[model samples]
Target: MYKEFMQWALSSDDSWAGLILRLTLGLVLFPHVAQKLFGWFNGPGLRGEMQYMTTKAGLPVWLAVAAITVECVGAFLLLTGTGTRFAAAGIFCLFIGMILVVHAPNGFFMNWFGKVPSGAEGFEYHLLVLGICIVIMIQGGGKYAIDKLLQ
Candidate 1:
């Protein structure tokens, strides 16, 4: 069972699936980051949201800054597949922190609704991104990724 699971998870084929995952995660997350960094797409912008996260949400300023840095600026790296593996690592850690620190109080574990489990406020998306990041990390960026050129 373990061997089969590892085999499936580590398969080298990353064309369609990686393309879909990369596009979807990047597009879905881009707006949120923009909202935090810029006022794009009816977003709150960096100053406002980061302030709120610290004051209203009681988050440490550094953590808030890190979130802003990762979600907004770091997202560009992920989208462009420029240093894809490292960008994915940042995103994965960010999501993990969000789950443990922010959402866990709402629920201890993910609400197993789909392949990538969700939480009280649609953690499904984060989990999906996490899975995609994991896949991409192991297989590396595919087709149009900058990693290909570098390699």
Candidate 2:
């Protein structure tokens, strides 16, 4: 059972498409993870994010923590091309939650020019993330991936 599970988890086909998706998505997510985890890029950081999610967003502590952890850890996994499908799925779910909880109320299109003044931005970015997640989930990790090496 363990062997089969490992085989399934670590198996991946070598393809440039997968590699491109993994690397691009991973790099894109990395800054957000750093911002959330270390307060880089003037982000709120973990503690501040937790407070905001709980108080302003009404998310549970556990959920907020989980979101942060997934973004941080999953970005590494994606960057390393290890468990690409699972990481993509996790990111997909995270985007869904964020869209439903936060971005939906803002309507389509990002503020872009501070047109909304104080209103939140739209879910356009979330849709892009979701699309990328779907692509990665379908393709898995390709060349240079630990999964491919193990396979």
Candidate 3:
């Protein structure tokens, strides 16, 4: 069972589609991770993010920490094409939580034009990311991925 699971985890094809999806997801998420963890790109740093997550978002400290950790580790894994499924799954759960907790009330469209009265963004971005993650999970890391080495 362990062997089978590991095989499934490490499995990937040589298609460029998987490679493109993983890389795109990783690159897009990295900046957000950097903002939350390191305060880059005008993002709230760890302290600010924690406060928001716990106080405003109402997430427990541990869950908030886990989410941040997942984003950080998942982005790295996605970028390197290592443990692609695991990384994609982690990110997938995180986005689902975001949509449920925050973006659901904002509706489907993003606040691109500041037209919404609430000024809060919608779940479209989260949906897109989730879709990408799902693809990566199904396809695995493609060409040049370290997962290929493991397999």
With candidate 1 superimposed using the best TM-score fit, by how many Å does residue 29's alpha carbon deviate from the native?
Answer: 0.7
Measured by lDDT, the strongest candidate is: 3
TM-score of each: 0.75, 0.92, 0.96
Per-residue lDDT over 1-151 for candidate 3, one digit per residue giving the tens place of the 0 to 100 score: 9999999999999999999999999999999999999999999999999999999899999999999999999999999999999999999999999999989988899999988776899899999999999999898999889998886
Which parts of model 1 are misplaced by more than 4 Å?
1-14, 108-122
Give the runs in model 3 whose Cα sits over 4 Å from its true position. Answer: none
Ranking by TM-score: 3, 2, 1
After TM-score superposition, the amount by which residue 33's alpha carbon in candidate 3 deviates from its true location, in angstroms, is 0.7
lDDT (tens digit, per residue) of candidate 2 on 64-147:
999888888889998999888888889999999999999999998999998898867999998998998897877778788887
> Each candidate: what lDDT?
0.69, 0.87, 0.94
Q: Give the C-alpha miss distance for residue 83 in model 1, angstroms.
A: 0.7
Error of 3 at 39 (Å): 0.8
Give candidate 3's whole-model lDDT. 0.94
- What is model 1's C-alpha RMSD? 7.8
Q: Which ten residues in a row have the lowest lDDT in candidate 2?
A: 5-14
